[model samples]
Target: MKKHIFKLLAFSLVALLAIGAQADDGFFSREGKYNGEDRGKPVMPTQLNATWKQECSACHMAFPPGLLPATSWTKLMTGLDKHFGADASLSAAQASEISAFLTKNASNRWTAKTAPLRITEAAWFKAKHNEREVASNVWKRPAVKGPWNCSACHAGADSGDFNEHGVRIPK
Candidate 1:
């Protein structure tokens, strides 16, 4: 009986220690919440696709693939003819390549089951840029433009660096 009890206690202690270690490593935050690896981290993929960069940036910024999920990317890619009221269609080969890259690098850490078409429509984006965080009038500024224009405030937005510390609200 003593041996069994000792073994059980030892196992419990080890399990607790492992949990604590993982929490410290950011899997579970100190506040007992599942923070995950993506929280407040840049979403850029190390290997960028040249075709995606060139085509997507022709009209607007080439958003990082991690901004949306695979499903959203698929939806957007298939509807290029009516893309945001503009014809942004690409060749079949180009579309396939960009689709693969975007899906592969899509938001793996997004907790929400939803697949938002626009990055600005994501729950995480709304929470970060809520009214309390950003003044309503700020968006109306000629230089600031709107939420879609991330580069207006985030200097390194093109590179996937949206850290608040580096943000500069344009006049």
Candidate 2:
């Protein structure tokens, strides 16, 4: 009986240690945390839509659909006539195609139920661009303009590559 108990205890200890070692490799880490490449999932969908890419980039960078939730994209798509105070209204067919693309590729990692029309209003965006990481004065710079001008700091913003290591703040 004593020998059996000792064997059981030793096996349990080894099993626990093995599990701990695996956890250290981020097996138990948060979903979006420690994502090595494409940082959480490719912000840009592997399949791109021509209508969405062309129309959206006409005024601003064709923001990666993963930047906002599906609900946000729905609202924005339905309000293209008043898009950011501009009459960006598109034809019915164009609008429908673009809308489908935006909503389909919208952020999967956004856990919050609240949908923000503006990308800057998303919780994840704010957290990543908090004052601690970006100085207040940085937004005031003519080159940077504001947070909306992501391409000013993130050269690959159009390509959906916002990796921290690739950031290049302008003067």
Candidate 3:
């Protein structure tokens, strides 16, 4: 009975977080703990849209609908082949489309701004984690990486909403 109660409580908590986050007014949801809302903005060229999921997701975690400014996404998509750690080379046609879509939905263009906690160089990443040691991989642990992916930990990251009050870091 105790185990079942704990499970129920956990599920309920997650559900409330997912829904209550958007309890704000018409525009913008709560900022995620890590990714600032504006950073998750989505924008890109037209050519890459169709191939984004298949090609991009191969190595990178899915490019959540939000995660970068529109201009940033455009720049990132244009330079896909040279992605930070991997080479995602693609043909000219495919790359173009993806670029279009990403730029349109990225963070910069959005009105509000949100910043998430991260240990990386990204503005939000740095600001959010300013207090932590530069070498702390607690944010990069394999278990933390796979399940508490940025978007998951930073709720509404895909949409560029970040509110510290809503953060619930997992152990």
Judged by lDDT, which candidate is best?
1
For each candidate in turn, the TM-score is 0.76, 0.76, 0.51
- TM-score sort, best first: 1, 2, 3
- Per-residue lDDT tens digits of candidate 3, residues 44-82? 223345476677667644565455555456656666667
Q: Report the Cα lDDT for residue 149, model 2.
A: 90
Residue pairs with colliding backbones in model 2 are none
Local accuracy of candidate 2 as per-residue lDDT tens digits, 47-139: 999998899999789999887778888999999999889999999999999999988888765555678888886556766788888998989
The C-alpha RMSD of each candidate to the native structure, in angstroms, is 5.6, 6.6, 12.9
| Model 2 bad stretches (over 4 Å) | 1-40
Q: In candidate 2, residue 12 scores what lDDT? A: 99
Estimate candidate 1's RMSD in Å. Answer: 5.6
How much is 50 displaced in model 2, in angstroms? 1.0
* Model 2 local distance difference test score: 0.78
